[model samples]
Target: MSTDPRLFIDAPLSASAAIPLAREDAHYLINVMRRGEGDVVRVFNGRDGEWSAVIAHASRKGAGLTVADQTRPQQGVPDLWLMFAPVRRSKTELIVEKATELGAAVIAPVVTERTQSDRIKFERLQAITKEAAEQTERLDLPELRTSEKLAAVLDNWPDDRLLIFCDESGDEADAAWGGARGRGQPMAAALAGAGDRPAAILIGPEGGFSPAERDRLRSLQHVVPVTLGPRILRAETAAIAALTIWQSTCGDWR
Candidate 1:
């Protein structure tokens, strides 16, 4: 990666195009980073490929840049989405950040029966994803959707898209986490048969999925219940682990 600062611009990018920076972006580049006139910076707009831009002017009011040339053509991650029930504030932010870094094309927060934190700071999460994409050199930011009920999300799920449910609980009625009986198939094992289908990974909240939620998910023909491992994982960890599995098995990691 180049030492120059990278930013996610919202303007069209092309050679010689003069793009004005947003207020916050101007503050960041000019005041915070101390970048001045003629300083080189990297930029992307999710539409255009990465570009090399030179700072046109830097002042207290704002800053602007002139596109020098395209550095890389536009590219995108595989068609993978991550649907996770929001947890605590910090953990939820962690989930979104890692999901972006792990190449999730979309990140959604789902409300499940056992979900504790149904509310979310949408703009804050968006900022998190944008910063993650910038630092990770992703050409586009992941589509961060608003929080929705898991049932509603499932009801409208596309038939062609595979939904991988990370089910940590088992069918054991007498043991912790419902025992180990009738647990979902291991993640890698289940994904081995999944091929390269467009897919999404669903992770439940800290309490895992309610029995009814689990049953409904298992009954869906398009939903594949897969275990992360014998041990239970936090919502954020499960999101990261599941994305890694999918990417390695059927996504760009190959």
Candidate 2:
């Protein structure tokens, strides 16, 4: 059988040194996994990379580990970002988890005019992303940005980065309008030319972008509005779908 999946705990780790894992983590390893002394596990911090560790001690309160050896080099993710309006709590968690799995370099919540939810618990969301990355064997965790106004985000948009806005309204047009203008070429071809330049996929709120918001986004020079087919998709679904498309087109999917 494959080795047990490693976890991302808060404790610091050094090669050949012992570190005490948190009480919560200890319960998971000792109680949940039923692991005991001398059992091997893996651990990683976003900074130190991945390491093989052995369970030095386990108790109901916590667990301890001895860092053994570095198992892999730190991984580098693509320069893609997932910018979306925050949905419900469950869906928000889903987005964070799936975005990490899809290799999003950053997770940004953009507050649009029609946004329903304004409050976001950053700590909880970060934990979800970290867990997802550890389970998926991703050495890097996507940087989670605080919620920013849509207009503010547009104003601060980097000149070199391309914004792929998923525009549902573009489907009715006979010809490609907005970002779809140059989409005649295959996605792979378009992405190949993008090089290391940063790219972002913009997903709107549940109610979708307002007409004024659409107009403003379309007017931006860096924004490239693309269609996610003819169907109207929910905000969370659209985020995953758009990210998947981008990854397949220009990311590490190959």
Candidate 3:
């Protein structure tokens, strides 16, 4: 494991150059971590890849760091996207955090008729993603798109990206119809055999997807309706469950 501390900031960094870290970051490093000058850290931009750096100056307001060398090149992410109807604020944040940790290439919010929360705090969600990436040692942040209507999302579905729709309508008697088993083979096993095509998992709202929405999703060739389980799961639980299955099957869980 790399000993360098991971920090996410928006400032530009260049080799052997000093860049001022953000105030919040500086506090976290100095006041929080009690680190002083010359301590090593790792940084990454969604665009510039990852780099090794050392603290040059520390202050109460902020700190400055000098880039030492590039550590890892930007890595290619999985072709998986996570789309879900917005739920409550705290759970929504959890979903974003877990999705990032699970290696979702994109995090999209789809507004369905049953969606409980129409508004999302983008900044808060972004912060959750950043924190998750930092802790999980991920170099890239998932692309977060604004919420769109479910109908609109279906209308613009990419032809090649398979949509794994988590539905609740399957027969309880069938093992395949309930829980993670129906979601497909374990995420790791599925991804090992999967080609380069991108895929997405769609999670509905608290009240679940409307019957019409389910029918529409089933009708789409790109959408594959699958069940999470026989027992009803909360919106947030379903999102995490689906993501866990996908990551374990086809993403970084392996």
Candidate 4:
């Protein structure tokens, strides 16, 4: 399996489609991977399913692969989104990678009162997600959205979609938020009967949501607040944990 490389192409994919590799991919395939003509590999675009392709042509500057047949048809996961406040650069990257692996349909950066940075390098994040999708054998890549204020996102919230809010201050015994999920409300219980309903998991920054922000989220009609556990988790850890819990209960993993 290691011999057969799986690559992600940004263009539409179909049988006999000539995929032109970028300079870096060309270098990796030819020099690093040490592949010759007639080698077979798998390729996919977010829009297209995975396909079997062969190296029809190779060169120093570039190599062209010919798409053969569809290995897996295009499939989408549960309409789950990850709305997180951006943290430090490396931790933010970790959140993106894990979210992709854990099956988030969309990844949007939300700016809360305690958000550390507003700048999001989509190019770098896109590359990381594509690499992660390829490595994790995911058919589709998670959509990345620009950073937006929490208030803006809430004001524009859709009526049909459910927002799973991870409030650090939530209590298992608290009457609010239906109590700690997976214990009182439980993550699975909060998501019960919500199959195919547009849902999102929101994680705040390291400093957590501000008092006003917490009140605002709690007051939202469509928001479902839940707790991770008794222990406090970092921003990145909470993001991954929330996605995993969602997938296991209501996403593709189920």
Candidate 5:
């Protein structure tokens, strides 16, 4: 593990470039981390490769770092997206952070019929992803799409990409647990046949999707419904589990 601080510098990074640190980052390095002039750190922009940098100037007012040679070439995550209904603020942030660490290329909040928290703080979530990416050594941050209704997203979903629906509930009222039979194939089995197409995982809210929402999702040809397991998982757990399964089965982890 590297002890040097890693930062996501949004500027164009190149050899011999002197990039000024953002105020919060400056405070973190100078005041928080107690780093000073000539101290080395690592930096990366989504477009440029990772680079080693030396703090050229550090002060309470600001700090700057001079870019050194590239350390690693730019690499992108596999084309996998995570679309989950937002839960409580803390849990929602956890989903975003963990999704970034797990290498989701895009993070989208989808509002379902039973979604508890329809609103999202995009700026705050973006910060969480940036920090997560920095800590995880991801070459780039996941693209955080604005929250959208599940219906609209489904309507606009591209044909080339597949949507994996983490369906935990079904519409059969008389059936056990409202229809465990509604549970699609086990996630690993469904993903094993998903081929190499780009994919997204959709996790519903705590209350799960409304019957209409479930029906609509099931109606989609490109949607592959799957179950996490026999046990019911919390919204956050479901998101993490779904992402993990997808990555292991159909993404870069393979």
Candidate 6:
């Protein structure tokens, strides 16, 4: 792994712009990383892309950087969203981290009958996504939305966005939702039909969606029910698998 550190900042970055580091960031660079004046570090704001900046000084409990050159141009990833029912703390973190690394444009948490009542730690999740994006070379952080009821979300979903629902029990769903009748329709088949349309993936919690929730999802005109494979997967595993397949099929990986 590259030892050079990369950081996400809220300030604007332009050639010759001297960006002041926050106290926390200065501590990390000056103390944790043991960086000093003239050291090279990479930085990016979600909108500005990434740039190479040199440390201007190692001051009393703070530091500054002089923006040097653009390392990368601002670019957008495939317009893909990952909507999932929050799982246990660790698994939920796993989903967020993997989703960011895999290039999800948005991370939305949905509440279903099967989802636990406990609230997600939004602040921590944001930190996790930021760290994951930095580690994985993502130029932008995925947009994180607050948790919302699944019904309200479905009711107000944009008509142009296709929702690929990862139905764990696709074989057991009714025809209206494209269940067993759509048995041969794997996720790949769904994406093949999606073309360049804006898309989102919805994964249920560990116990899976309730019967009513499944029925409702199936009845949505824009929603496509898909199977990962013959084997059942943990919620986090399904999230990772679905993202990989989506990216390979029609995402930026193409």
In candidate 2, stretches whose alpha carbon ends up further than 4 angstroms from where it belongs are: 10-12, 170-192
Q: Rank the candidates by TM-score, best first.
A: 5, 1, 6, 4, 2, 3
- Which of candidates 2 and 6 is the stronger one according to TM-score? 6
Provide TM-scores for the models.
Answer: 0.94, 0.88, 0.87, 0.91, 0.95, 0.92
Write one digit per residue (lDDT tens) for candidate 4, span 1-254.
Answer: 44488888888899999988877677777787788789988888877899999988897667989999999898876788999999989999999999888878899999999898988998999989988988888888999998899999998999999999887654422544354332224567788887778899999888777767877877788988777877888889888888988888877787
lDDT tens string, model 2, 1-254?
33775878565667888888877677777887878899888888777778899999776556789999888866778899999989888898899899999999999998999889978999999988877887788877889999999999998889988998876544433243444443223334445566566899888877767867876887788777676665677778888888887877777775
Summarize candidate 6's per-residue lDDT along 102-196 as a digit string, tens digits: 99999999999989744899999998998898888888899999999999999899999999999885445545345344542589987895768
Q: After superposition, how far is residue 167 of candidate 3 from its true place, in Å?
A: 0.8
Q: How many residue pairs clash in each candidate?
A: 0, 0, 9, 3, 0, 0
Candidate 5 lDDT score relative to the true structure: 0.89
lDDT of 5 by residue, 83-192 (tens): 99999999999999999999999999999988889889999999999999999999999999999999999989999899899877644421533554356888999888
Model 2 Cα shift for residue 35 (angstroms): 1.5
Error of 1 at 85 (Å): 0.5
List the candidate 6 regions with Cα displacement exceeding 4 Å: 1-3, 170-184
Model 4 scores what on Cα lDDT? 0.83
Point out where model 1 deviates above 4 Å. Answer: 170-181
Residue pairs with colliding backbones in model 5 are: none
The candidate that wins on lDDT is 5
* Candidate 3 per-residue lDDT over residues 93-123, each given as its tens digit: 8889888888898999999988889799998
Candidate 5 TM-score, true structure as reference: 0.95
Query: What lDDT is obtained when candidate 1 is compared to the true structure?
Result: 0.88
How high is the lDDT of residue 38 in model 3? 88
* Cα misplacement distance, residue 55 of candidate 1 (Å): 0.4
* Selected candidate, larger lDDT, 3 vs 5: 5
